[model samples]
Target: SIFASGTNLDVVELWFPRLSDEDQMLAVARFNQITSVQGSAMAVALPGIVETLGTLHARSYRLGVATNDSTSGAEKTLVTLGVAQLFDAAYGYDAVANPKPAPDTIQAFCDLTGLKPTQVAMIGDNRHDLEMARAGGCGLAVGVLSGTGTRESLAGIADVILDSVVDLPDFLSARVKETI
Candidate 1:
């Protein structure tokens, strides 16, 4: 069963028994193939995501990825997508004792980037991301209608729901300008 909790931030918890080493390897291979295909095919950034990340990176805002995937898997995905350098910090399950829903990975990212939790925003495509961000005390929790996260799935937990990542930069820029 899938378990989840939190509001404006949620934890999506999947209950799966530990995989055997062989199964893990198989899972990784399948994941790699799927991710490689998706990354290679997406020639454009998700509407506003790239611009936001790029703008933030250029402004020296600490950028990080806290994921439940393995380190190698995350690295491969980022590299394949040609966005590895955008992140100032990256944390995966292998990099921490606990993964999403536990908050360890996000906490590790905060530690590595030297950013307070309130200075960070967690953008994700799932309930797990929302939960993790909330648990980690992220300032904002944004859900994208990408991957498997549907509007209903991300409702309530997300402070803002975007159609794609492409909207992020524009949204953030507007917010920052308003604050200034």
Candidate 2:
């Protein structure tokens, strides 16, 4: 089951592999245009997400999003979730010279916050996110089950596997020492 994951560029690359590079670029452009037009309406905020983000924000955690989506797309999703104000920043794949599995997004985050890689925690529901965390030497590699990854797939890769991001604050408070 090759579900849609990664940046729009990556997904579009997968979708149009045999096309000429220019055609692929055009395809990505069209895809992004369609997504910008329809993404917010298609978004579904996971239960407890708003509360979780609010809790983290209120607790003064400098939170940011490092998504594979385009920055605008990620912002739109957050807006749809009613939690756009909770984040300090949101970095899309385009925000970096390299995308996930490359450490670039994590590097961007570290640079923005003046935090060392080891002081940061990386959480996502896919392999690329965990891989990026490891490559960036992050303090934790957390995998959630609410998205594209299965327990079996994330096993032995992520430092800790949780059911969803809703469980993050408590786990981080209690288990910061365990990491990849």
Candidate 3:
């Protein structure tokens, strides 16, 4: 009955397929309201996040965000941080029928970019992120310790674990050199 793959919103549609569109709107509004409050305190970007994003962009790597947060909310945060233009695309829970761990969002992203799953890497700080990467057949599942997920929780799920996204550029560069 209940799936533990993703957030409550991700499974809400599965459980309540009969829910009226009006009711779904109300639920989304309520969730957005709650997130708005939480987002107030999170307007600021995490340390090294901007630099890492900029560096990744400069390296010609296309970037996209597959967040469970509302699209508007994620966009607002990115805009506020001055990195919105650095991203090629951003998908929220509402963008897909099923969110992370189901791989719908990841598939959508791949389709949009005309890239295969094997050409992509999913970098996240949670099990859902890693699961989504795996389900989508992504080449890499990278876990970070910068969010709520702990090392133990992300272990075995992620192909590699890092202290934070800030370390990603160096890690990727090293991998490229190793292959050369």
Candidate 4:
């Protein structure tokens, strides 16, 4: 939805324009370079992601993804992963004036969900996510080892570093109980 904005879409198009008619046929092949990595693309949901999302959904927790990816790219990845339905809201790079390092994206998510920043937890794999969570005043910033980020890389930024998204359910389960 936000991707319709001219400023943002222009930037995205500049970086990754639509493939030519001929190249369109090679889209999958080209995409495979990044997505086919052992743990690179979001299309291959990490271990424990489904169960974690299921638990969160079952508990009626509001789930959202605030990412620096374009809306179309985000939707494509989610659909490919078969988990598009799990998120209550999805904000893309074009959703706000500022991206990751800025709190705008996360703030937009909070605004859309009618949730305060303090009620949200940001689960990501990068320094930018941690900075955004902090800037947005999120309840917690959880970093996972599924991506390029390492424990040391996330050292001071994250509130907690998890082995993988799979461990998220247990963490949230405990947190929910504690809050109650």
Candidate 5:
């Protein structure tokens, strides 16, 4: 994913190591311009995302989003999808010391919500999300196949894997039952 490159430092240091610092800044600025402008148009809520998130919200789940997107871009996209109100908080790359594959965002989620890592279930569609969850010591790290990641890619990282976000409610219900 384009966002995997993260900030200017990430882009220069990881993606284009040979780029001059000045060039890296220019690249980052251009990338941000394109992404921010196209962000809303690119916001495609997958099938069942709204319904599933709505159901969870109705059940009083405290939902949040931690993404590599810019905060304004994430908010705009979520609002465009008509699901922004469902989330209690939304953190993006700039909000934390580090982005995904590090624990900063997840830790920010915990801090913002007054919840412990053990009380959180991190559900994502990619390896970075799962890795972030793991790094944060979340209780559950779940992977969904609806996005870029394959089961093979998420194997051994996610505690449980689901076909899509729509399955989450049932999966949570089953987990509750198991505990009882």
Candidate 6:
């Protein structure tokens, strides 16, 4: 549930409810340090992710990241995965006043890409991501099963539910044909 509703800071508050405000913040800092050490150790890219991103790029589709993680953290992971060059933009929670479940991240992407909200597709693995897409009036809200979301969580919100990002190219092709 942390993935859906809270950040690492929220974890400190949730787990140590008895802690005073000052102590909770201290706990958060320690928690962040622990996770930061673990983060780089677990930065592996999903299978075919690089290829999938390359496929999108070759088609001149804009690509980027919108994550609950910090922008610099996302960028570091991308660089570690050797896919840093594939993305056109990367926005994280801190980049916007309101994070997921709000329109901020999607709007940021659209603004930078010169895209109308209706021209954008928001692909993610959580209900918050889909909610944000809807709030921003995105053309498509795609949910993938690879991370925190489940079928029940995403069903009413997503325009499509994919097994994972590897399926994106085929899904995109199908959508293109439908329009044609």
Candidate no. 1 TM-score: 0.73
Q: Residue 69 CA error for candidate 4 (Å)?
A: 1.7
Off by over 4 Å in 3: 1-24, 33-41
Model 3 clash pairs are none
Error of 6 at 168 (Å): 0.6
lDDT for predicted candidate 5 compared with the true structure: 0.84
Q: What are the per-residue Cα lDDT tens digits for candidate 1 across 1-180? A: 132222111111122236665765566566545644564465354545566777878877677776665465566666666788998766765577777777787778777777788888888988889888899898999998865688998898999998887677777878799999
**Predicted structure with the largest lDDT when compared to the true one:** 5
Better of 1 and 4 by TM-score: 4
Model 4 regions more than 4 Å off: 1-42
lDDT by residue for model 4 over 37-74, one digit each (tens)? 42225466776677788888888888887766555566
- Give the per-residue lDDT of model 2 (tens digit) for 21-79: 89988887787767755886699888998898888888777788887777877788888
Worst 10 residues of 1 by lDDT: 7-16
Model 1 regions lying over 4 Å from their true place: 1-52
Q: Which 10 successive residues of model 5 have the least lDDT summed?
A: 3-12
Candidate 5: stretches off by over 4 Å: 1-23
RMSD of 6: 2.2
Error of 2 at 133 (Å): 0.5
lDDT accuracy of residue 77 in candidate 1: 66
Evaluate model 3: give its TM-score: 0.85
What's the lDDT for residue 112 in model 5?
A: 85
- Model 3, residue 130: what's the lDDT? 93
TM-score of each: 0.73, 0.88, 0.85, 0.75, 0.88, 0.87
Model 2 residue runs over 4 Å out of place are: 1-3, 176-180
Residue-level lDDT tens digits of model 5 in 83-154: 999998888776788888799988888888899998999999899999999999999999999988999999
Comparing 5 with 6 on TM-score, the higher-scoring candidate is 5
